[model samples]
Target: MVGTAARVTVAACIAFYLCRYGLDAAVMALYATFTVVALGVLARIPGSGRQRAVTTLWVLPAGTALVVLGTLLAVRTWAAVLGMLVIGFLVAYAGSAGPRIAGAAPGMQLLYILPCFPPYAPGTLDQRVYGFVLGAVLLAAAQVLILPEPVTPPFRALLADAAEAAAALADHHDGPAPERTLARARTAADRLRPSRVPPADLPASPTRAHKAMAHAAETVRTLLAQLAALHGAAAPRGGYHAETVGLLDGIAAALRQAARALRAGRRPGAEPSVAALQAGLDPVRTRRAVAALERLGVDDRLVFLRRRALVVQAADSAVVLVLATRLLLGDRGVGADRAGHAFAYARTPAWVLWWRRLSTHFTPRSVIFQNACRFALGLAAARAVAGVLDLSHGFWVLLATLTLTRTTSLETRWVVRQALIGTLIGAAAAGVLLALVEERTTVYALVLPVVMLAAFTLGPLRGPAWAQGGFTLVVATLFAQVAPVTWQLAPTRFADVLTGSVIGLACGLLAWPRGAGSELRRSMAGVCTAVADAVGRTASRVVEPSAGPADGAGIVALNRALVLAEESLAQYQSEPREETARQPDWPAVLAAGAHARRGERLLPGRPGRIGDGPVGGWLRREAGRTAEGYRALAERLRTGGPDGPRGAPTDPDAPQLLNIHGLLEVVPPPPPDTDTDRAAAAALLVDAVVWLDTLTADLRRIHGEMAEMARRAEPPGPRLA
Candidate 1:
């Protein structure tokens, strides 16, 4: 904060002195300093010095175009009004897809207002541009050189925290469930998104450590859950092998290395091996455990070991990939193969792909396209009003309208309230300062540094409303130096802001009406469907690993869906209560996703295709049924119907599941040599059946909870309010 304040103060004062010395173009330079500081400290993107410099360079050309267009339109009253309306709509529409685009909208609107200032001397335009470039460079340099903070620290901390949580899960420490621990990890990871450059890949970006961290955390959580479930459902009645305990310790050791690597931002050193544990499984003991479990018609420990091994393998692979991202070709080391496969279709002919993307926007379902039109319409209306009033600086009205509107009505209303209140407070403060001092220019110069310093400090401390107030005061003071400062100026500015706010609010509520609550529900439903699809696919893999290893695409889709759902939920929670929206059990939904992912990781690329007859058949059938259950749940979420499993829930330990128990515990067992491989395969088949059955039951329960959520009609209390 101190660095930012100092930089802003230095930049603004320099610009002011240049302007006082007859470089009249320094006015824009002053604004540029504010822009650079604001984007550096407040905005999410263009975070690094290089990225910010690039973004600023791009903004110059783009902003210049808007100014030229505005100047052309402003010559004729009708053209100016019409242009404002159109420009307003386009900027608003462009941002309907997400917050990043929405954030850029204000800057676009500011460009439109830039040309509305009094005409400059011939060649003074170049001077202003030069001033802007100079200020931007100085500001960027300050951020890069002054007590620079490392970009990786916060991200490293997030990964380290998640790894510790995973280790705790493996140790069966008493605390939150693995699902809850992972969710917190994911939440933290989200905040760790890289501030500077755009993410290099979709779903999971190899260049983004946070993405890898979040995914690894989920994998660990799932592994722990599988262990817990197997322990609960299949209590091996005999003495446990010390090897099993050692295997768990090995997995825990790998997790510790993962945490250390993430903290150090380097590749992991040689990790503990599970090979010793694998060797310790005496065939005689394994045979007895399998036989005893089969006799009891329960899950087998050997089967659990096989499944656990798969998860450990996946988790270790993920951690290694994250650590390797810093090396040469690091992004491609472990995880890049999957990422490449996911985006291989992008290699299609560029023209064809571009055409398809463009065509998508023309469809009726394209909310972004429709939003753009609505924004234009709203701006037009606001411009017409401003034109009729013919107030001093009528463009301010259009600026307000453009700045106030957001993706949702609720958000627009909130912004309007803040902008209006802020403008009033700022105008009053500026008016007082102008009136109090006998030496206006001297007081203005003295106060400029204080205001610039305060703007940086107060904007973050207070919310957007207070920030807006500071912004208004700065603008009023700057303009007063170039033009006349009068008490009437404050009221006139207030009227302009009021007019724009009303127009923005009206457009938000009435045009193509979509509330945050509705968007939230829709996003949540999408997440449910995504989870269902992953569960179904995983069930297939468990039933028939020989078909192929579980694809990474399913988990990727799950992650993307969850991110969208979380974003929509945040927007919804920030608004007033609405009818037909209920508090969703997000944790339950998240847990279901975790289960699906775990199930996927549990399957091997190659399972024994030749298995014992009846046991294998039953396993396949159970897996199919589990897939069907997940599909049903997905359909229910999409359609919002109550059709779920019609009959009572089946017992996980029922007679059907115990069928393998009878086969293994026969009074006269088959020849020991012949039954060795067959017995192991049969035991694994039984475990698969139990796991699928249990997963399906959990899916059904989540489906029921979602159904109940759908039925909620009354408005709930507003958490954000």
Candidate 2:
């Protein structure tokens, strides 16, 4: 905050001085000063100095375009209002592309708002553009040359650290102290959870590399869970099976190599390919071990089979991590492979990716779309009200609306109340200052920078009230320097802010007032449904390879649903809510979706296939039951019912949905045969069992968490009861 304040103060003061004194241009000076505040304080572009400089440079052209558009539209009130509506929506919606765009969105809106007011000044367009360009250039330079912000660890480095942690956990899966190892593994996994990761560090872009990185993070979490499960499983008397040990060692090495590759920025074509590591730890060995256990007629055959299944599941997760990492490193070969369907955009053109990102949020169901609409309508209404009322400093109305409006009506109300109080206090102080100064331009000039320094430095550190109050004082001193001002200016400023707040509050109530909280539930349900469809489709393909190539549609749907759910969760976390509000365990819900998608991706890619037989028929039935379970879970989420089981079944021995452990215990193994087909079928069945088990565990965890939250949300029963 200190660094940003210092840089903004230096750049803005310099720009203001150059335009005011050197050029004697009041319009240019005003624009130049506000430009610095808009870009520096309002739009907080995150990253190192160089990254922010580059981002600022990119934003300049957009800023210039908005200024030109605003100046042109200022010819009439209706034109400016319409322009505000369209431009506001576009700028806010563009944030769906990436963090950089999202960070610059507020500044872009301010650029348009500044010129689209009563001045009707196409004649001053040149001055506005010049001042904007100057301020932007100066700010960009200041970002790099003036007390640059300290660089934080990069997101890729975080991912690398997670991979290294997972590697360590894998290496000691059978350590003497299982509890300690499991705790460490869980902690490492939690670090990669979306809720735990910083928003600035999230790879949420639609580009291939970002998507791949996100998938790799989720896969690492899955791998850690598998390893933790292995650690907790009762070890055989002679220790882990030879195949399990080999696979664990192989997985550990592969993870270490991945971490090194990430840290070194190695390309996908680098030596010792992660994909090849899968071949070295072949599932064939796992199948042979299962066969040997069955042949020996060991009393602990079922336990050994379960252990082998876990090892296979771990190997599957490792393969996904390998593929995702490869894609992140720009491996087009992986995109061309059959498994690339999971990452369809890995090789897509940039323009197409942008289009997809925008189009995906075009629906009313999307929180981004809802936010854009709310923002646009609020700003448009504020502009229209200011023009109709012929309010002085009309842009202040727009600015108030821009800053005060939040996703939820409840939050907007809270902010509006604080802002109003602050504006009132600031107005009174400004009125006193104006009365005392009485046309002393020098006093105003001297105090301007000090006030600016204090305001910019403390506003954000404080709350919206501080920001509103400090900003009110800033505009007062600024306008006093530009021209003559009286005590009346304070009241005018407060009145404009009040008008904007009213408009913003009205829009908030009329639009999606509940914010992502409600949408998050719907999105989670959508994700569950998509996962169920994908799981059923993948199981079908596994049961019958000739069921045609795996339909990419289900994968795409699941990906889209997961993306939307994640975005909603992010917004929901930011919005204000009552303490007693009933909310699902969002992180757990997200994990369940990720697990389902990962299972779908891994099912068809396993080493073997299953033909229609007793085993295949049983697998199909189990898949149907799993799909039904997810569908039921989705229904429960939507209906706001308890996420956990409602009550014990009338028949305790009846087969339960997602009870893979019980099902596997009773499932008949493939008939004894020396042929490879039987062995392949047995291996495929094991993969299905493990995948189902993992998914079931995730669902149960989500259920338990949700049930707890629901219980907490319930009010105390009547004393009479």
Candidate 3:
């Protein structure tokens, strides 16, 4: 907080000094400096020197161009208003693309809005542009030299630790926690510096290593899930047979080599082959273990338990084998290096992505586009109202409108309430200070920094209202030197802010009002849909081992959707509630997704022989049924209705898991002389049946919750008066 206060104070002093010397376009320097500092603080984008430099370079020219254009348009009120609409739409659309773009949007929008406050000539425009460039340079220097963030060591350590975790999970050792390991990896990746390493060729280059490691982490998590299933109550206390253990050992060794390659920032000269890992676990030896169990007259349940563990181990080994290969080789195949393609491969083309994003605003259903339109219209309306009232420094109203307005009605209301309260308190304090403070320099030098520091520290803690007050105090104090600091104008300024706040709120409510509650439901439904799709895909892969590993891309998508859902739900809970019902069963949705994901991982382990008889048909049928149920649950959640597919929904009350005991009756008790293949088949059938039962139960619970929420839905509240 203190550092931020010092930086702001120093920048303001420099700007004021430049302006005092009658430098041409010096005011532009002051505006640019203040704008850079304010927006940088809001975005939290200056985490690294390179990033700060890049931002400064890009924004300096961008801000200058926008300001110059807005100044030109400001010659006529109608023209300026029209220009504001175009600029607002573009800025908001850019922001909606992603977080990186979102951070820069506010600074760009501010540049466009501020220039319209005062008309400027061509000569003045030239001066302002020059001032903006100088200010940007100074800001970059302050960020890099004054407080240079340390880089390299932390990032390297995080990468190394994540790799170690992946390797350790493959080892199946009790030393490291897989969840904690992956969590650390995620945290590190999130905070990684934007700078890329040199010689970024080949598929899994250092530049793309994080993505590889992340994928590997997810694969390891799946492996752990498999391990959990095998280690459950049905499995024996004794460890896996010699052949299965050997395969795990080979996978462990392969992963260790992959970790080393990641640390060295290169793929290994000779990639570890999954074939070699599979070869270590001889099929004859694994079959012999099953034969031995049958010969010993072991109970069918015991025999089934032993074989289930082996199948799980085999499936887990296969998954780790592929993931370790991916970690070392990257997303592109081994031949990618010879192809001489250096750039990362994206699923969609750049032009197509942009076209889809921009085209959405053309439709009536595009909330973001509508919100942007509303914000622009509201700002224009505020400007008009300020002129009608003949309010002094009416740009203050427009500033408030720009800052306080948001996409949803609830948020806009909250911000307006806070801004009005803060402005009133701040304006009153300014009036009192003006009466006592004779020397303007004292307030500028001393009081300014104090208020700025308070604003920086208390604003976030107390919410938007307190922050607004701090801003008001800073503005009032700074302008006291130029304009008369009278009680009359302070009230007028407060009134301007209130007027802008009202206009912003009206626009939010009137123009395509979508509450946070609806957004949460939508996000939640999307996540549920992704989970259902993943479940179906996993089932398909299980039915055909040749179909390859459960698509890592699907799990990754589910994760991103889950994150969006959680964020939207949090925002929904924060808003004032009209409906008294509890928040939608989000945790239930998450639980169902988790169960579905784990069940999907278990599918890859079905023994090859299990595909032959009635057992095979039963296993496939159960998996298909579970997949269908998930699909129906997804639809129900999405539509907020009980219109799920017509089928026998799993009865949560009467649970029936196809255990080893029941399976023995169906499989003819795999005779004492049964071949190794039959013994393994019986065990795998039991495993599949048990997992299906578990997943079906989870889906049923989710379905029940979805039905309840749908039933409780009230008719839309009375339309806005």
Candidate 4:
């Protein structure tokens, strides 16, 4: 903050002196000074100095265009208000693209608001453009050349660390300290959590590479859980078969290679290790191994199936890791394969990617859309009010509205109260200063830089009140130099702020007043339903591989629903909620969605299909039960019910018809010569079992979390009355 304050002060002083004293252009001077404030204090572009400089350079053209539009619209009251509405929505909605655009949005809005005010300044448009360009160039230069911020760790490095941890955990799944390795792997996975990572470093953008990376991170966590579960299951009489052990070792090696490639900033070469692992675990080889185990008198069918399920699941996760890593390293060719469907956007046009991102948030259910609408409406109303009242310094009204409004009414009200208090105090101080130093432009000029430095430094550290008060003093001093000012200016500033605050408060109440709290529940419910549908569809496809292609619509819905849920969660965290607010386990909800989506992505690609025999029928029944369980949970969430469904079924017979031991007795093993049909069926069954097991475990965990939250939310029994 100190560094930023110094940069802003130096740049603004230079721009002000050049325009005001040297060129004697008051319009240019005012625009230039405010431009520094807008980009420096209002916007918070994050990245290395070079990145920020580039962003600033890109914003200049947009800012110039807005200035021209605002100047043209300033000729009429209605036109200005309309322009505000359109410009506000566009600026705010553009945030869906990424963090850089989002960060620069508020400052860009200011560029327009500054010009769309009284005096119908079309003739001064050139001055405004010059001032904006000069301020932007100077600020960009300062960002790069003066007190630049040190670069933080990149997201890829974090992923690489996680991959290494996963490899270690895989190698030690049955080692002496399996629990310790699992814990360490889990810790590494947690580092990639959305809440832990910086927004700029997150892979949440709309690009295909980012999406693939995000999914890969989620899959890594899933891989760890599978390894732990596999270790917990009873081992075979002679440990895992040689083939199974070899497959596990291959998975570990592939993970290590991926880690190395990511660290070295190179594409993992051709994914031969993954392909080899896949080939080694082919249906024929795996089925022969199972038959060989049966021949060796290893008759614990339950243990046999459970262990195989875990191996197949782990192998699936490894494949996704390789594919995602390749894509992240700019291997666009990976998307050509069926398994790489998740990276569909790898070769998409940039504009289409951005458009998809924006269009996805166009629904009212989206927090981004809600915020954009609320922002646009509030600014438009403020402009209209200012114009009708013919208030002096009317742009201040819009500025106040921009700064004070928040997603939730409660937060907005709190901010407005703080800002009003700060504005009142600062206005009184400004009035006294004006009375004491009348016509002393030199005194105002000397103090402006010091005030700016202090305000920019402390305002963010101290909260909204200090920021508002400091800004009030800043504008007071700045205008005093630009033109003569009296004590009356302070009262006018207060009035304009008050009016804007009222406008902001109204908009907040009228538009999504609860912020994401309500939307979160709705989105979570939608995600749960989508997950349930995807699970059912995926299970069907596994049981019946020819079951038409994958349910693309269902997959897309699940993705969209998860995106909305995540956005809502982000917004909810930022809003002010009541202490007594009862919320579900949000992280668990997100995990459930991710797990379901991962299954949908990987399960259908498994070789072979289960015929409509007893095992296939049993698998379909279990999948139906799992889907029903999720739907029931979704209903509870939608209706705001406290208690969730009971924990997942733990009975041995619950997962299969007549239990695995009984099925083994009834179903004969394949002959020494591998039958392609039997081999395929065996492989599909193993994949299905693992998918269902993992899905149920995740559901059980989420249910337990929800039930715990409900128990806490429940009112105590009359306090021993």
Choose the strongest candidate by lDDT: 4
Question: TM-score winner among the candidates?
Answer: 2
lDDT of 4 by residue, 1-721 (tens): 8989988999998999899989999999988888888988899887777777888999987999999999999999999999999999999998888888898999999999999998986789899999999999999998998898777678888888888877786675343336677678778878888788776777767887787788778877777777767766776676666766787787888888888878888765765246776676575345644553364235333445555567677777887787788888878876666576555566677687667677889999999999999999999999999999898899999999999999999999999999999889889888888899988988998998898898888888888888888888888898898888898989999999999999999999999898887688778888889888988888778777777575355666788888889899888877766553556577787777887877777667756666667766777777888888788777767776322322322323222221345345444465345477666666556556656766776777767666666566556886664
Model 3 lDDT tens row, 1-721 = 4454555556555664565344534456456555655454554443355565566676666677887887798676676677787887777656544344555675567667766654445557765666556656666666666555444343334444444544544454332235655454445333332223211111121123433443344454444444443433242336555655566567666655555655665554665445556455435334544454344334532445444444445344444434444543544453232111111222324464355445533433344455567767887787677655656677778778877887678778878998898989988887777667844655554676677667766776787888788777777666664445665657877888888888889987888555455555556666667776765665555545655553355655665565456545544555564444544467777656665655554445445444435554455555656666656655545565212222222345222333434334445544343466655554444445445655666666666654454445535678987
Cα error of candidate 4 at position 640, Å: 1.9
**C-alpha positional error of residue 646 in candidate 3 after TM-score superposition, expressed in Å:** 20
lDDT order, best first, reads: 4, 2, 3, 1
lDDT of each: 0.52, 0.78, 0.56, 0.79
The lowest-lDDT stretch of 10 consecutive residues in candidate 1 is 197-206
lDDT of the structure predicted as candidate 2: 0.78
Note each model's CA RMSD in angstroms: 8.1, 3.6, 8.1, 3.9
Better of 1 and 2 by lDDT: 2
Which residue pairs show collisions in model 2? none
Clashing pairs in 1: 85-380, 89-375, 89-376, 93-372, 294-661
Residue 589 of model 1, lDDT score: 62
